[model samples]
Target: MTALAVRQIGPPRLTKGLESAGRLDWDAHRALHPHPRPLTTDQLIALCEAGSLHGRGGAAFPFARKVKATADSAVRRRKRTVVVVNGTEGEPGSAKDKTLLRGAPHLILDGAALAATALGSLEIIVAVTDPDAAASVQRAIAERGLGARARVVRLPERFITGEGGALVRGINGGRPIPPGRKSRASTRGVDGLPTLLSNAETYAQLAVLAGLGPHRYRKVGLPQEPGTVLLTVTGSARFPAVVETAAGAPLGHLLDLCGSRAGEGVLVGGYHGAWLKGEVATRTQVSRAGLAAAGGALGAGIVMPLGRGTCPLGECARVARYLAAESAGQCGPCRLGLPDLAGALTALASGQDAAAARDTVARAARMVTGRGACAHPDGTARFVLSAMDAFEDDIARHVADGGCGRPVLGVLPAATDARLSLEVDWSRCDGHGLCADVLRGTVRMDEYDYPVIPSEPIPARLEADARRAVAACPGLALRLVPRTAHDKPRPEPQRGR
Candidate 1:
């Protein structure tokens, strides 16, 4: 694990006044952000509502509303509530969660305790993927004498494993995938109890908000979205960092602070976020509303600036392929459509019939939109579709001359293949035609009416259809199988030293 390096480009808020420092151990963290006035459940809710605090996760859900739902539900049902700190940063383009966990573990823990105490429960579960971060939390738990009341759970590194439902499922001793149906963790989660779940940054922000209250918290950020936000700025920047900036700070200013050059386009939010260029990127602020106003978002506080000299289409294709492979493989559209989009983009980037490739990618994106168990399909589509607009000129030149004359610099991050595949259980098969019918583009019927599946990875657009087919199949023959197929066999060991 890399050493946690953190700084505040602007004045620090959620960063506990740290401007240029490395990881803050529990002592350092407690010293910086000391425990302050504790709020009751209603008081905490009122403070969040007044400050208009939203989740720092990609969704940016309102913190007060979620807490209220959980608290109200628990009070009514007479059930013990739970507070889950989601430190699983699955987005390839993000390091803010890990940074927060490693740099200032106590801030998140304080927030977790604050939230848990407010919800009338002492149980706190922190789900984290990074071992280093998890260890930090565990150390802090012991130091604080939290014992079993607060625990750190090590999670898998899969892309969608950070999802709330998936985290709950894993905690409940099931595979870390979202349930087939739409189920909110706030109502039924963590052993069938009312749960309050949010990302690491959300908890840290809550801690900051709890200590500072509304009026003082309003000193830095926008009137609507007040307080500083932590952003992970990477890609083409001179110095990559998890920066803390005021909510309404200009996007251009943040880029400049990170030493980003002019002519570099930005992918705001994250992989599931939008790309922005020209005046839009410069004028847009860091707030959720501000980014949304500029056809972008502040999702999970991730900012990636694309260098001017790189092939934008190539970068898009690389990310698209990575996203395709990252699919949960439970939905038809995500399973089939993403690969199509990636292939089409790759073809276009490689100077193959650019016009046709563009059309195909666009159509594939449309087909997959809003057709997944989660927002993965829709978010992936948004990411790819927006690239077309942000790089329109490049598309024209590539289409006309079969190239842009620039090499792909691999500016965006791509995940290593997990060697995951879809599998069929013959014993569970009853010659059901539903898989083939729904996944018409991916699955075909065999001579005996059983599915004839391909060996290659399924396209993402077919994710929804696949999920439907699986759900509809009475025999439950189809399943998404993840394997260590990408791992190379170990070589024989050399003589010991």
Candidate 2:
């Protein structure tokens, strides 16, 4: 909610022709990017395919393929196609989308309008969780006289609420969680219409790609990833800014530009992304393929340098605990397994006979992978497992004598538990076993057939089932309660001298 100074680096395609003078208003944006070329569906798809444009969202899916699928589905179903610009920016430590939306709102609106027009749709929805971003977008829409074509909808600031299907469900007045079954928003989204949903940055890139075409757009970045990427550079850096860099820019170069020194490690992507050691960081490239080769990902365009002096293992444990709490509680493996993994990591961090705990963490990470309704469990597994490999020596030292003698600086960010958590009133409870049956992992039966919950906070994944159990409770015992502010972790400790 605070005002963040967003600065760019490299040639700056998406954020091109702008300076830190201030937010680029509608008139300035129109002047900079004059008369964007309007393209039909086929023309847009051809340009995207030629440029090999990919989603800036964590998945890195082929953008052209999504367009083709949505267009084809729309034609076949005789349904209107829709465009949803995702500005949820739910990934912690990532602020590029918000930066783009807030700084250059017109650019995002142009891209969304382009997509909607190309797909023969008249509707575009820009979903944002940040109040400032929403206000900026609304003002841009009004100024551009795009009131008929596009609208901005504010969403609850939660991690999972940003997901494509979950956002669609929320927009359509359903609970903001992915449906139990696997379904693409392209096939059914936003009032059962075929929808083309993508990250807000992706749409901004679309606007750029539309103007530049395939040739000029391919000039700066790699051939594989032929465009610039916006990265939110943070963690132990002298200057934390939203950086725009070419796709193939060396990871270490960005680190140096962000004021990172030698001996520092980098967490490529975001929390669910991998942590590469300093040596690996130098060799790593900013593109997806390059990062893949370096055992990392260009996820959500987040590049965080882990400076010297902090404990990588301790930081991993803290992030793991936060990830466990953010689970949508839709699947058993994620709802139960993540907390177990976090517990194991916590034991390891505290130096409490950690070898067994380390093994437990590893096994739990593997067990939870590919078992969730969404990619949350799988991505989280990758994050935890990668920490194990990246910090192998630290794990070894901790297991040998309990710890590596370093403090957790909390470099990674996570949302505090601000939502309502399920609560039980003892006077209203009548030892109903139904709550335990419906919410198996969350509600356990006590000796008297009453539900006994652990002191740990319940994850969002289990919230739906918890509500179901509450409704099933004949005694009207269960209710949702806001967690205490004290439950939040302390402010991040300062790193470096």
Candidate 3:
């Protein structure tokens, strides 16, 4: 894990003492934020409504509506309501939630306690993927004597594990992947009871709201979306820090604070986000409404401006491949369409049949939208389509010529685990052609029908198929192995004749 830099653009609220050191103790946290009077369920809902509090998770759903839905479900179902705190910060480019979970666990707990108490709920579950965050939250729960009422659960580290329904399923001891079905967490969650599930930052904001009330909280940010927001600044940023700022702050100012030049373009949100031209990103504001107006989103509060050192199209293609690999594999759009979309984008980025690749990318994106069980396909489509729009000039150059003249420096981050290749045990081989049959793109059969594995790392689109090939080998001769320095780099797809 990278050492995160913490900074505040304005008067610090959530990140007040975060820069100083390790996790803040309960006493120190209380000293900074004296406990306010406990809010009733209605008061809490009213504060959220007035403040326009939204989930810090990618969706930016209204917190008040989610709360009311959970409360209503609990009343109607005659079951105890469960409060779930999602600290699973699965976005590779975002670290805001982890910063909050590790630095100010108490604040999150305070918010969760308020909701759980008001909802007449007995259980408060904090689900986190980072070990440090889990430990910090566990210590905070112990310090507050919330052992009986609150507990911390460590979930698997995956891009989609943080989805509300997925987190609920994981907490119920199932695989932490999207269920491929739309089910509200409010109605059926954690032991089949009504649940109030929200992002870690959302709950932390509630704690702040409880302390300052809606009027004071509205003083700092825009009138429409009051209060501060936490953002993870990456890519060309000099600081690459988790920044706390007013919700409607200028995007350019944040870029300047992080020492970004906005070289080629800026990616707002995360992998499942859109790209904005440099000038457009500079003029945009760091709010949902503002970003939406600029053809982007404030999803998960991630802002990454591309630097000139790398090829922008290549970086987008890299992340597109990663998003495709991270799919839940539960629906056809995610399992099949996303990989196809990624391959097309990769081909376009490689300057291979640029016009056709672009068309394929656009077509695949359209085919997958709104067809998945979750928003994975839609978000991935948004990311790829936005890249096509934002990098049109570069695509034209790549089409006219065969190169971008810039190396793919890999400025955009993705999971390191995706660097894998296939190996074969020749001694155990029975000339089975299953591997070639499954991995049609990367594997081929020799004259004797023996599998001929490529030395280069498997392409992201073929990783799942590679695994299936390994499993399907009759002689158990094939295995998936991590690519090392000795392995050859992934070869670019063949260009059009």
Candidate 4:
């Protein structure tokens, strides 16, 4: 047995052993996955259609449609079809995929294996980021003897690196960046073969279909929700908990689990997620449909609690800029547009005309809106805009006054893969304009008077100038170190704006 096997259960219950007993008997889980429910192409299509299962990888695309696409595309292809389980859990605060992977690896495996069998494909790949998670999954796969059919993929641990497109690219041995066009995984995935890709939790739910049967399984959840869902909860209240609730469970109770407090807020969905006011947090429920209907999509079941200490607007702006920096740079709009919005948000937080900030946002939104080859700019912009709505009062206060009295308690996550930055001490910076002159496209002069960095990744061509600017700072305010220099784990992707 692995050293970590059934270990670390707080409030331990020997009856449940180290895992959730409701899932499967330990020995039963180790047996080769659910008896294969082999079906003809037409039957498989109808089954998926009847279930209306959506891609659980955050996009919510219909599973039936995805299956049809992959099946049709792969029917004649020479390369064998493949199934990919995305356990990357890249969102800053989301941990559903990881939880399932580490806790119920076999269930996820059954789902993946079943999916591969259904698609008449032999290859299955499970991708994860954490070291322990990888080990757990590898062990589970081996124990079940499904290891021969499925491979465990350990990926680089970066937040955005887990996106569907990024994961696809990573499997192809390239940096994790979104593809430029309609490059569906069903089309060119895993060496140009048709493929099925989905989140890891999705696979576990599929495993339930084995023992419970569709009729029995359908009894527990609502028509829309149709299953138990997992959420990683964090906030002002108590210890962080991975709580599972029925889909569409009322938001009010979810808030009770999250707790209530004034001046404290919650980032409903992670870095690219929207902020919910104290009022919303108090009343909100936990469900994908609930959150989505409430003007926010719970991107991969991540909910973050905002403690009372930090200024909400300040926290958000810090994260906005960080999200901008994390952009893959393949898309011009995300590459160019996000930085602009980030700068404007920073100005607004430090007290600028709220209307003017809105105006700048409008322009930036227009430039970066539909232009990106990927959704990074769109997602980041959505997050900032939503924050503007949810925390209007805080925004007004920060914009009206130069500084919010509340400390920027670093509640937000940073984007730098490594925590290196050329920080400018506005106090020491006398507006020499030299840094701007040298760094041009990357750094610029501002209206209220500070050198603003337009991009974080110091490209090789401008790396020299960036270094020079760091050296040229008369106040010695500019210093560079690894981005992780602060020795804090940034909110998943909520880096400073």
Best by TM-score: 3
lDDT per residue for candidate 1 within 1-497, as digits (tens), equals 24435667566767764555556766777777869577798998998998888999989889999999999889888899999999989887788888778767888888889988878775999999899889888988888899889998887786778888888998888888777579988889999999999999999988888787788888888888888888998888887878888878888898888888535368988888998875578888888989898898888788888887677887887788777767777878766777677777776776666778889889999989988888888888999998889888888888888778776766676654334456789999988678766755345554356775544444443455556777888887788765465633222111111
What local distance difference test score does each model get? 0.79, 0.79, 0.84, 0.65
Model 1 TM-score on a 0 to 1 scale:
0.83
Which has the higher TM-score value, candidate number 1 or candidate number 3? 3
Candidate 2 wrongly placed segments (more than 4 Å): 1-3, 262-264, 419-488, 491-497
lDDT of 2: 0.79
When 3 and 4 are scored with TM-score, the better candidate is 3
Question: Total backbone clashes of model 4?
Answer: 21
Per-model C-alpha RMSD:
8.9, 5.9, 4.3, 5.3
Q: State the lDDT at 46 in candidate 3.
A: 92
Which stretches in model 3 have alpha-carbon errors above 4 Å? Answer: 416-419, 422-437, 440-464, 467-480, 484-497
True-structure Cα RMSD, model 2: 5.9
lDDT by residue (tens digit), candidate 4, 297-352: 76666666677666666676667766765667676776567767776776566454
How far is 212's C-alpha from truth in model 4 (Å)? 1.6
Q: Lowest-lDDT window of 10 residues in candidate 1? A: 488-497
